[model samples]
Target: MNFNEFELHEDVLNAVDSMNYQAATPIQEQAIPIILKGGDLLACAQTGTGKTAAYLIPILDKVAHEPHQHTAALILVPTRELAVQIDQQIQGLGYFVGATSIAVYGGNKGPEWDQQKKALSQGADIIIATPGRLIAHLQLGYVKFDQIKHLVLDEADRMLDMGFLGDIMKIMSFLPSPKQTLMFSATMPHKIGDLAKRILNDPQEVRLAVSRPAERIDQQFYMAGDNQKLPLLSHLLTQVSDTSMVLFTSRKNTVEPIVRALRKLGLKANGISSDSDQGEREQVLRSFKNREFPVLVATDVLSRGIDIDNLSHVVNYDVPRDPEDYVHRIGRTARAASKGTAITFINEADQKYVLKIERLFEKEVEKRTIPEELGLGSSPVFNARRSSGGGGHRDRGPRKGPSAEGQGNAGSKKPFRRKKPRSKSAAKAPSSTPTNSAS
Candidate 1:
């Protein structure tokens, strides 16, 4: 459907047109009218499906046409990067409508905090924040949301996964009751439903089919040992003509080492993780987007909500435990109907996780043999059932040697130890991921 069909404010439509948005995505088509009608909504759509614009457009329209002296909308996202991305989108779409927005997130120095304070106190038309930082502001008794008309939980499941449920509920207490609440998620788990029950008031539901990797994405898997991964990745990188690639590792510590190894092999690569300060993270992302570097090595921190268009390839340096994350990682590529490639490195211990990923894809992913020219030795056999007992080393803990980053010599022998699942109590602890505020 076209933006005109929504009957949005003229200024809002003008902004959309200026941005060259020709048609509404599936989520926008189903959810915008309900939001325009002042009804709460629960929407589930895949990443890169224009989910941000789906909610941002109607909110901008309301702020344009409605009378409001205080903040009109509060959008809580799971990461600082997403908060910034959404705020930038609002700037573009809200330009002609004169809607103001502020992104409140953690991991910044003093100046950012003061700016956020000023925006909150002065009532920016919209506030996009990570839960942790917003809570810190609220605790100071300076932030007010008594007049907030719309509350949106973008990536609701991710917030829950990061143990932000308590923080989210706390933030909601500051908002006025009976406001329109919108919950948007890439996937729906039972926890999301429970969250909706507590927060949304008879919300309308819009669920698109879970997105599969685009057919244009050429997915390939390689069986390698931990030590062989780095060399294999280096070999693969040399063969690909497109250097716009992202290498995703599950643990933050592996980021720098991997980048260093790739650079030593004469590849233009950079790394970012939670350990990197907010400014550094932003800079690295900007550089990567500008193609200053051909490869970006990062943790799951970049797995969701960080948009870099025209990405040609995604390398899963480590298999993500959750099948959905695997989708999100590769979804970084093959965007906007573009063709791309996704490569996954599977060690003996990661085979089980690969099985889970393949199940999500509803078919067996093609496995390729490691290039023998590299002399990386025999690859680990693909035996998910036998490896189901958890024989791989969890990508946590202190790094000691070159092998710690999967860059050791091909013959290096690192013992595999089973990683225990986090207990329920441990799982509920505040996330150490950079996205959450210290509060």
Candidate 2:
């Protein structure tokens, strides 16, 4: 069905037209009407399904009609990235409607928020914030929720995964008891179910489906040795040059090395991990969006709520630990109803996970062997897949990297270096006769 059939407010329709969105996705079509009716909602939709617009459009309608003197709505998201993305969506939908919104999250200084808090105190329409930052504002007496008519919990499963349930409950307590509450997530774990039971009142439950990704994506897999995975990925990047791609690794330590390797190969790549500075992460995201950087390598922390429209490719460099993460990882592409591609690198060690993932989809993933010209040895064991990427971290200063345990000599302590030679002059004469210590 076309968007005109919904008979939404002119403002929302105008926003939709501005975005050139001709039709709504299944989840958006199902949930938007329910949300517009001002009823409590429990929506389960996979990532990249336009879930943000499903709620944002309806909330904007509510805001445009029922003008209030206080904060009218609160959207609590799992991460600062999601919070900012949602805020951007809300603003885009409400741009001509004169609706105002602010994003609140940690890592950003309060100076920028000070002005927003002042405007909000005077009366803000919407607030999209992370739970911790939102509660911090509340504790500082910078926000009041006397007029919160709509409350949204975006990415509820991730919030539970991040152990923010207590903060969510606390924030819920401060809002008016009788309000329209909405919870949206890709998967509804037992904890999310319990939280919904407590928070939602006779909510309309909407589940698009389980284990379904956008049909426009062509999913493929590559079987290679673990040691060859990075080189293979490097090869693929060269083969598919100039496409905006997202590459996912399983661990945080793996990100930097892969990024460095990609850069060394003269490809524009940035790493996103838990330890990355928030400002740098934001810049990486913005650059990726602008096509200034064509590739972003990240962990599952970015699996959901990273809404880059028309993202053409997603690569699974490492199989995700959570089977659900596999769905979200590939979902990054094929967004906003556009066709895309998803490729996964599977080595022998990943064999155990292959079946579990296949069970989730109720079918075997089509496996294709890498070209023999790559020279990865045959019948490789999983341990051969145990490590990938450059092994050492570049220290920023004089401090040594973390030392290995039980490896240091008793008389002399030196961190293990994988490649540097051990000089007999420095080692043999070190303990007994230290002539002079460097000042």
Candidate 3:
């Protein structure tokens, strides 16, 4: 349905029009009404489904109508990039209504901390935060949540996977006894259901397609040996000019080498991983988005939540061990009804991972043989059409069950909360709170 049919506040309608948003996504259409009615909701939606706007539009509409100066709505996200993106969307959608929001996350200097502190104290209408930094502010003691009317856990499944359950529970403890809680997760693993049981009060559910890559993505794989993977990558990019792409490697150490190799071959490339600080990561992403760089080599840290408009392709430089991660990586391309290409490099080392990825999709991914000029023939390791479902050197015994990160008990106990470091050296140094903290 068109957003106009929802008869959202006139101000919101104007902002939507200005933003050129013509229709609500399925998730948005299902979610906005329940949210506007102040009902608790548990929504199962993937990254490309416009989940951000589903929550933001309704919350912004409420904030505009009710006119609260106190932090009216609080949104928790998994990454620094997500917090920034959500805050930016809040601005774009809430523009005509003049709604205000502050993104709260670590990886900032004293000035950012000061600015966040001021907004929290003076009551910004909406606060988008990572779990750790908000806990740090709560420890500082002037922060407010008692008046927060709405609470949203965007990417709730991701937060639990990152081990932020403990932090999320602790944050909830600071909110008033009665408040509206909404959860948006890409998938509902049992732990997510457990989290919903604890935080939501009789919430309605919206479950669309989940844990699958968008159909618009053109999926293909290249069978290459260790010596030929780099050449295959270069061949793929060289075949196209000025393509915006994100290449994912399994380890941070692999990122730089791949980026340098790509640059040596005359592609504009940059790399991002855990080793990069928040500011550097943001700058790299900004440059990648601006087309200042045509290729970005990133680790799984960029797999999930960074929003890049019109991204043309994604390359899995190293196979992801988890099927879910494979979905998330390809998801970076083919977003929001746009078609794009996803390529994977499969060596003998990557065969088992590829099998699992195929199992998740219930079909084999088409495999492209490395050209003779690239120094490899078709992979002899496994037949692409008829994989034993068990290829590679080592036997992958059996899939392990969910780990402690996916356990409900992880949320029951409170973890010790540390105050932000104070000594000058400690304060200035870039540090990380738990990756799951408020993710």
lDDT of each: 0.79, 0.71, 0.76
Candidate 2 regions with alpha-carbon error over 4 angstroms? 379-439
Model 1 over residues 195-245: C-alpha lDDT tens digits?
999999998999986757677888989986666666676677666675799
lDDT of 2 by residue, 300-368 (tens): 779888888668789887566467888888999887658899887765546556556777888877777
Candidate 1 has a TM-score of 0.89
Q: Which digits, one per residue and each the tens of the lDDT, describe model 3 over residues 207-247?
A: 99988889899888887654455555666666675588998
Which candidate do you rate higher for TM-score, 2 or 3?
3
After best superposition, candidate 1 residue 21: deviation in angstroms? 1.0
Better of 1 and 2 by lDDT: 1
Ranking by lDDT: 1, 3, 2
The order of the candidates by TM-score, greatest first, is 1, 3, 2
**Whole-model lDDT, model 1:** 0.79
The parts of candidate 1 lying over 4 Å away from their true place are 389-400, 403-439
Comparing 1 with 3 on lDDT, the higher-scoring candidate is 1
